[model samples]
Target: MQYFIQRHPLNYDGSQLQSLFTYKNFGLMGDSVLVFRGSCTVEQNEMVDMEDVVAQDWIHSEDMLHFIVEHFDMDLEKTIVRQRLLIATIKEELEVRGVTTLRRSGDDLYAGDKKLSVSIATLSPVSTLVHCGLNISNHNTPIPTIGLTNLNIDDVFQFGESVAEHYCAEVLSMRLARCKVRGVS
Candidate 1:
């Protein structure tokens, strides 16, 4: 597992949830989690979640901190697990930084009634992809939103790095546990 923070601001239009996004965009080979600052506008054509499309939910945000994870294994269930794990890691990081009133509802995060993040997981032909975006500014969103800046978190990149680091560690820990265990007769 590898992680890097993208310095440039890349707008996420839901098209980046493809395999090799990290490798093609940032040159990080193998399984990787990339964090960046971006604007999110996922039109219906680019959406992978059918529920959102059926509900006509508009996924948009003015400014966000985005995390894109790509793993070679092709398992949607495992990818969803990783998606939730990433969300939990973000909540843990926020709590560690002394921020309160944060809640995890499935793959999304909330600060009170206002939403703090959005996420989804799906499988490509070659990899499992996850996109998790944390709101940086509450403007230009379809729903009531709360951002990191609202909670006094100014170092967005650092926050992203911390979340990615912890997430990678947790994934590695799980892999280690699986490999080190002996099979019982």
Candidate 2:
């Protein structure tokens, strides 16, 4: 899957967006200023929950592994190992940074008090993806509508962008190392 992160206005109303804005000022506008859009292809498989409860059609990561090995010519075992290590490191960093309320259950990380959930998975053998969502309800209007909210859109975009840059650097380093070993440019 491919994704994009872009800037928007703090207010949903189109009129609030200024004709000229710097990235720093745009970030100051916060969550309402960023949007993340993506599409993914999911393969389904059955899995048992923590309580041994069976669940159907869970998103399978094997397809992603196959795609990555086929397209990127990376070793599947090495990629999976790196992904596991990266996720564990991220969780530890979050805790060390004082995000003590969040807990990891399998691949899903949750912040119960904040009504936030973040899921991390290997999108491709060599690539990992992070998804974040918030639970919210709008009560000011007569019509009642409830949905998962995006109160930290900017934060999410920044995190994703950082991950992408890091992954690209790692891939480039691997290619360079291989070339050096083979006496190639």
Candidate 3:
């Protein structure tokens, strides 16, 4: 370690290396913005930064995001640490898409006999409007703009069944394409 540091000095030039430096500052240029289009963060996730994205910055209102979405199969013990890592991963990806900060929202499981809608709602009406596609019903609620966390998963089978029924699709087909549970474990 001492030899490596002596060979290549990493002097802190008094400018104070902010965490934002990790992003490589791609948001400065007008033409270099990233783009991604897909159902990227269902079984996986997509995170955005709040500080990087301004109020006036116009983003295309599509279900797709303009960044790389990652999927992981983790078996960690603690939720807090998992949340922190997820936040960091999401932050890095969001920066690539010209966004900053995250807003954690409460998740709701709306279920009926053959219907269900799993949605997460932000604390801020602005965030809810901006991210979650929320409407006028949340005008009275305030959106928190600090730290963000991910929601938990439950009964994927039930969810799949509901989605298939609602959309008139095949549950087995989707599972065959995405799941890794078929072959040898």
Candidate 4:
């Protein structure tokens, strides 16, 4: 259960609909540009700049999926394929760690007679958001469930860093392969 924040850049036009930044290296998925905008203090004076500021803030997995579908005009079939692929990868990873009882249904993974559940969502084509929850019961009486949010930021950050590193390396390899195939040196 790790999460990474991805920023997407938008350019404002006369209309409310903004344009997304695309990169050639991203292949069919396209790329998102990370832009950081904040107020800067100069001489003890804080000033706010007035710009179109076409940007989407840090969003959760579900929100990120919707944002991609809407902004990138992704078809439903492609979305479902991506979602299934991501869930399958997560299921395989969990199974490798001795969690063989896990069952995947749609975007959720359940284990131990519903005692544990992990909901997987895609933040983007390359990134996944996994939220784990544990069910607690007292003599057949169910109690409030505990979730991954209880974990500290340091733990989450460490996990996310590892995942990001792996993902970036895989993406870079794929891009390089494509470049070589295209005879682009």
Candidate 5:
């Protein structure tokens, strides 16, 4: 698994969660995760989660830290597991940074009652993809939102790097664990 932090700010519009997005856009081949600071406004047409669309829950934030994860294996269940893993990894990182009151409900993370992140996973022909976005600034959000700034996290880039590193390590470790296990006949 490869991890890359995108230095430039890019707007996430729900369309980047596709197969080869990291390879085509950032040149990171194979299973990879790309992190970046950005603005999020998922257009309806680009939305993947049917529940969100049916409920008319718009995904928008003025500023966010986005994690786009892509794996070559196309398994929706596994992809959802990876999505939750990333969320839990973020929660762990937050706790490490002294933010202990975080709560994770499914794929979303919350600081008390205010939402801290949004995420979704889906299949894209050749790959399973996930998009997780953390609020950086509590601005222009549709609902009550809490951001990294509110959590007293000043170094956004460093925080993002730590998250990417830990998530990649966990995923790689899991893969190793699978390989090292002997199947019972």
Candidate 6:
């Protein structure tokens, strides 16, 4: 059996997106049989109480381990256990930064000493690939040559111009801003 997932990627903002997206088989393409889901499904780590058992992260479940074990044939019980333990710590870090990481399939959040019932949408590995393919086709050009770190001041301006022209209807103000700095960061 092969597994592929498709979901829309979260935008920079917290708004829900209308466009559908996908990722390709969760990076498992070859019939040669690469990693199958790799013991990294969101459900394994987070606990969900759907009914709001308490006001905090005190929700209850028998355990998601079986669900995970059922999903993967590799029998990675140890990996899942370790990852589940680390999830709380990672959630704390995300809370400190005020960034809530979410996936499309699960419902639960760890934020600032609270376990809240939350649902977020995220792209599957397949949706990500589809987005890249569409971007390539629309541009009708080779992939970008220079990484962000390699960009110079002129390159930055040019890149902004290209983005503005393609995405924005008006670039006169943006073009003016590009030539001058407005204020301190």
lDDT per residue for candidate 6 within 23-47, as digits (tens), equals 2324433211111111112231242
Between candidates 5 and 6, the one scoring higher on lDDT is 5
| Clash count list over all predictions | 0, 0, 11, 0, 0, 9
What shift in Å separates residue 10 of candidate 6 from its native position after superposition? Answer: 11
Residue 112 lDDT, candidate 1, scale 0-100? 81
Off by over 4 Å in 4: 1-73, 115-154, 161-185
Which candidate would rank higher by TM-score, 4 or 6? 4
Cα-lDDT of candidate 3? 0.23
Q: Encode model 4's per-residue lDDT on 109-150: one tens digit a residue.
A: 555444232222223334322222122111221322222222
Q: Give the better candidate number (2 or 5) by TM-score.
A: 5
Number of the candidate with higher lDDT, 2 or 4? 2
Q: In candidate 1, what are the lDDT values of residues 1-185, reduced to their tens digit?
A: 99989989999999888999899878999999999998999999999999999999879998999999999998889889999999989998999999979989999988789999989999899999999999999987899999999989999999999999999999999999999989999
Report the lDDT tens digits of candidate 2 across residue range 30-79: 11112332222232221212222243332211101010111122354554
lDDT of 5 by residue, 1-185 (tens): 99999989999998788889999998999999999998999977998989889998889999999999999996899989999999999999999999999999999999778999989999888999999999999988999999999999898889989999999999999989999988898
lDDT of each: 0.93, 0.32, 0.23, 0.31, 0.92, 0.24
Candidate 1: segments with Cα more than 4 A from true spot? none
- The full ranking of all candidates by lDDT, starting with the best, is 1, 5, 2, 4, 6, 3
- Backbone clash pairs for candidate 6 read 21-127, 22-126, 22-127, 22-128, 23-125, 23-126, 23-127, 24-125, 24-126
Candidate 2, residue 26: CA error in Å?
25
Model 2: lDDT to the true structure: 0.32
User: Which candidate number would show the highest lDDT if scored against the true structure?
Assistant: 1
Task: Check candidate 5 and list the clashing pairs.
Answer: none
